[model samples]
Target: MKKILLVGAVLAASFGPTSVLAEEDALLVEARKVATSLPPKLIAALQDEIQKSGAEAAIPVCKDMAPKMAGEISQQTGWKVKRVSLKARNDARAIPDAWEKAALEDFDKRAAAGEPPAKLEKGEKIGNEYRFVKALPVQPLCLGCHGPIDQLSPGIKAALSQNYPNDRATGYSEGQIRGVISVRKSL
Candidate 1:
């Protein structure tokens, strides 16, 4: 009977809240590090300069590098990261993946209200399917690429039209949700 009780206690302890807390701490630490540091200041400064010079210069960089940046972050952290720009239109391909679409919307609302967004959990249907989501707020520097369309220069508009004919990521306000950082840790 004592042996049986000891085995039960061991099993319970192994699966206790303490283990879960440790996992959460580890994930949070990793997430914060990559989110805060991966996109260094120089990249942001360059984007700002491009925007100030004219939209044309900045849009190209945003269009070309957004996805690549996400990929790079994923490579650095071993966790998948995705950027989901908000869109006014609901076209098939623009928002093809339901999870990404939903996550973006949710993040937008929280960001607009000035509430800090939380990390998406497993089983949450955020951007692609069971995506774990964290919001990426538009920094002041990000205004160059993501700010209101009306403020964009003719050159920028032209560049945007040339690069992404179906681009729907414009007309954003400061502190808006520009994208998300997603991760799916292995079991």
Candidate 2:
């Protein structure tokens, strides 16, 4: 009976991880669908207003709106949400997570060579253990903040400086890895 119990325990343990991965993957897919659809439309609406009024007036609104959207997604789905990008051309840099950083670098290389925008990589260790990472390329609208320094408006740059003082999240072109959705299951 003890041996039978031990075998059952082992089998449950093996199945547990698989179940967790499936759940995590499902939650991640949902969260991505929500996040990706929201940001660009918000940014475009804000950009139209900015064109009429100017960046100074629009920056605060956009800045506030960004995290509010992230917060909304978090509230709706109990998963953490975030944004990350490649190091700026000028700053001494550290990515939000290293595994993500490496994946972005590879994604950027592939994109630069005229490839597709999204990628999935496996077994990339972040923090404590390996995880599956999905990198999505930032679109043209993202260039206003994440693009080259010369292209940024003074107000937007000021906003970026104030919001993310250690930011290395600029100088990204369209089709480059702006960041990723990194999800792992809680054991």
Candidate 3:
């Protein structure tokens, strides 16, 4: 009886996921791949720029090239892709709508509760679109530009002031959630 019960429990656990859950998980996987593909390239480009011309030179790459790359990704994926944060440097692009705001808040809580930001994500169907967001944690490379305001180098500060006079995307530590890659697909 004990052996039979154990086997039954194993079988049930193996097959327990509902079809809807399975589909959602698959959707999340697709969403994550599209979302994650850009950052690494952007980081590598920024690294090259910094190494060749210094950290200040990388500012334009992030401010201009990053958006262009994101736009290309959006064109390829046929889904709206963007970056947003609680403290957005670019007011036009970083502002989160109501749903995105809620998701970011939830992500913060989960990360606070020991969830790895790299593995953090949220997705849901809203009206006619399926929305997804993946947390972007502050990395070591990010600190040079997005670190504590007072701690920034003079050149970096001047560059930021000239480029983004009203920037608010600072005061972040490594491993902290800096922003999110937000994606949406019409259903």
Q: Candidate 1, residues 1-187: lDDT per residue as tens digits?
A: 9999999999899789878767666766665565555446436746675658754555545545655776777787676665444562213323425665676776666656767643432234223323355566666666655678888767666766676677677777766666665555443
Q: What clash count does candidate 1 reach?
A: 5
- Which ranking of candidates, highest lDDT first? 3, 2, 1
> Which runs in model 2 stand beyond 4 Å of their true positions?
1-28, 34-37, 88-94, 118-136, 157-167, 181-187
Which is the leading candidate under TM-score? 3
State TM-scores per candidate.
Answer: 0.66, 0.60, 0.86
Q: How close is candidate 2 to the true structure, as a TM-score?
A: 0.60
Q: What lDDT would candidate 1 get against the real structure?
A: 0.59
What local lDDT does model 3 show for residue 117?
86
**What TM-score does prediction 1 earn?**
0.66
Model 1: pairs clashing at backbone N, Cα or C within 3 Å: 55-156, 56-156, 99-126, 99-127, 100-127
lDDT tens readout by residue for model 2, 83-179: 5556632243224466667767877777788777764433333344334445656777668777898899888888778767877777778777766
Model 3 alpha-carbon drift over 4 Å, by segment? 1-22
In model 2, the worst 10-residue window by lDDT is 87-96
Q: Candidate 3's error at 177, in angstroms?
A: 0.7
- Between prediction 1 and prediction 3, which has the larger lDDT? 3
